[model samples]
Target: MKNACYCVTEHRAPLQRIIQDTPELTGDQVLLRVTASGVCHSDLHFWEGRYDIGDGQDMSLSDRGVTLPLTMGHEIAGEVVALGPDASGIDIGAPYLVYPWLGCGDCAVCDRDEENLCPNQARSLGIFTPGGYAEYVVVPRAKYCLPLGDLDPARAAPLACSGVTTYSALGKFRDAIRTDPVVIMGAGGLGHMALRMVRALSGKGAVFVDLDPAKRQAVLDAGALAAIDGAAPDAADQIRAATGGGARLVLDLVGAESTITLGLAAGLKGVRVVVVGMFGGQIKLPTVYFPMRAMTLEGSYVGNLKELRALLDLVRSGALDIAPVTRRPLHDANAALMDLRDGKVVGRVVLTPDPA
Candidate 1:
C-alpha cells in the first residue's frame, strides 16, 4: 500500500506531498488511517527549523535530532487499520486519539507514566518520527492509542496536544485555580484551551490577555471573567483588578518575554506562573523578587499519557467545553499552516483526511 503525506522538505518553504510504501508494522506496533491532524503553533517551529532563544540566536531542530522531509504534526486522531501480533486491547477499525509525546519505554520517567519528561532520545511522533500529516501512520505501540468513543475525530484530535498541555499546566496550580481566577496570557489555541480547562477543573474562572481584540471578545463570549489587551498600558492593572487584587495563578501560553513580564507584573505574592507556550524569548528578573514575593515560575511541556486519558474522560463526561475548531481538508495542510502562522486562526484548525 502507498501512503501519501505532506512533509517539511525544507525550512520555511511549502510542504511537499510525498508518496511512499506504507510502513510495515513490527512487534507491538499498530497501523492507523489518520482521520484528523491539528495544526499547532509547535508545527511552526518545526517548519521554521529553529526556535528563537533570544540574543540573536536560535536553537536548530537539527541539533535537537529533527531531519528534513519530516511530517510535522503531533495532534492526531485516527482509525486503527492493522495491529501487530503482540498488540492487544484495541480492536481494528476503532477510532482513537494518538498519544504523540512518546519516550523510550525503558526510562524511569516512562515507568511513572511521565514519558513527556523522558531524558532519552525523544521518540515523539511528528518530531522524531513520521506523524499524522499522512494518509496513514505507524504508531510504535498500541498503548499510545486512546479510544475516542463518540468524540468527533476533528474535535478530538487536538486533545493529544493543546487539551492535555493546558490540563497539565493547570494541574500545577490546583490550589490556586480552585480558589481564584487564573490569569491566562495569550488567547491563541492553547490560551483558549486553558480557559475552557480552568472551568472544567472546577476553578473559579479565568481572565484572558491577548493583543487581538477579536480573540479577547471571543474569550469574553466564552465566559471568561475579563479579556484584557496584553499591549495596553495598564494591562497588568486590568488583570489585577479583574482578579480582585492580583492573580494567584497565571498560565502563560505565549512564552515571549513580554507575556512573561506581564504575567509577573500581574501576579500577587505567592503566585504560581506556568509557562506552556513555545513562543520563545528571554527575560531578566531581579533575584530578590523570588524570595521576597514567594513567586514560582515553571515550564510545562505537552502532557503525559495519563493526563491525556484524564482529559479525555472530562470530555467524554461533557464537563469540558470543546475549544472552537475549524476543519479543513487534508490537502490544504500548507494553507492551514500558513493561516496559523499568519495569526489568522481563531481557535484550532483541524485537517481532516481527504478522500483517497
Candidate 2:
C-alpha cells in the first residue's frame, strides 16, 4: 500500500506533501486506513516548537524537538484492515479510535490504571511514530484501539486527547465534589469539552472562566451556568461569588500563572485544582495558599483506558455529544492548525484523510 502524508520539512516551514511505502503488517500489529485526525493545540505547539519536544524516542520528552519530516496526527480514528499474531479479540475492517498512547503494560502504574503515566509510554500516529496523516498506520497493540461503533469518525478523533483529558480531570474529583460547583478556565477545545464533561459526569457545579468573549460564550453554550473572564482583576472573586463564596473544583486548561492563581483563589475550603494545559508557563502559590484554603493543585495528562472508555460512553449516549465538528480534508492540515492557533474555532476541528 502507498501512504501519502504531510510533513513539516523544517522548523517553521509549511506542511509539505510526501508519499512513502508501507511496511508489511507485523504479526502483533494491524494496518489501519487513516480516516480522521483532529487538529489539536498540542500538535500546533510541536509544530511551532512551543512544546519543545526534543529529538528523542519519546514524543513527550521531545515535546518541542519536533524534528523535521514527520507525518503527524494523533487524535485519530480509522478502519482496521489487517492484523498480526495474538491479535485475538480484534475484528478486521472494524472502525476504531486509535488510543495512540502506548505504554509498557508491565509497570505498576499501568497495573493500577494509570497507563497515561507509564514510564515506557510512546505515542503513535503523530509524535513518536508515523502517524495517521497518511493512508495507513501500524497499531502495535491492537488492544489499545477502541472500536468506534456508531460514533462519527471525524468528531471522535479529538476524543482521544482533548476530550479524554477533560473527562479524566473531572472524573478525578467527581466523588469529592458531587454537588459542588466547579471552575473551568479557558473555553477552547479542552475548556469547552471540560464544561460539558464536568456537568455530565457529576451533574454538579458549572462555572467557566475565559478571556475570549467568544470562548466564554462557548462555555455558556455548553451548559455552564456562569461564564466570566479570568483576565479581570475580580475574576476569581466573581467565580467565588457565583459559586457561593468558592468553588470546589478548578480546572486550568490555560495553565498560565495567572489562570492557575485564579483557580487557587476561586477554590473554597476543600477544593481541587487540576492543571492540564501546556500554555508554556509556571504557577506558584504562597505556602499559605494551599494550607489556608485547604486547596489541592494537581496536574493530569490525557488519561488511561478506563477513563477513555467512560468518555467514549458519555459521547455514545445522548448525554454528551461533541459533534457538529468543523472538518476539512487532510490536505488542509496546516490551515486547520492555523485556525486553532488563531482561536478561530467554535468547536473542534477534525481533518478527514478522505474528503467527503
**Winning model by lDDT:** 1
**TM-scores of all candidate predictions against the true structure:** 0.95, 0.90
> Compared with the true structure, what per-residue lDDT tens digits does model 1 show for residues 1-356?
78889999999999999998986777899999999999987899999999888878999999999998898889999999998889999889999999999999778998887889999979899998999888998998888999998889998998898889899999998776888999999876677778778878899999999999988998899789999998899999999999999988998988889998998998889989899876767899999989999999999998999999999999999999676579898899999999989988877888898966
The residue ranges of model 2 lying beyond 4 angstroms of the native Cα positions read: 52-66, 104-106, 110-113
Which candidate has the top score in TM-score? 1
Candidate 2 clash figure, as a count: 13
The digit string of per-residue lDDT tens for model 2 on 123-236 reads: 445876777776788887777789899788988888888888888888778675567777888777676677667666666767888888987886787678799987788887
Worst 10 residues of 2 by lDDT: 52-61
lDDT of each: 0.89, 0.76
State the local distance difference test value for candidate 1.
0.89
lDDT of 1 at 26: 77
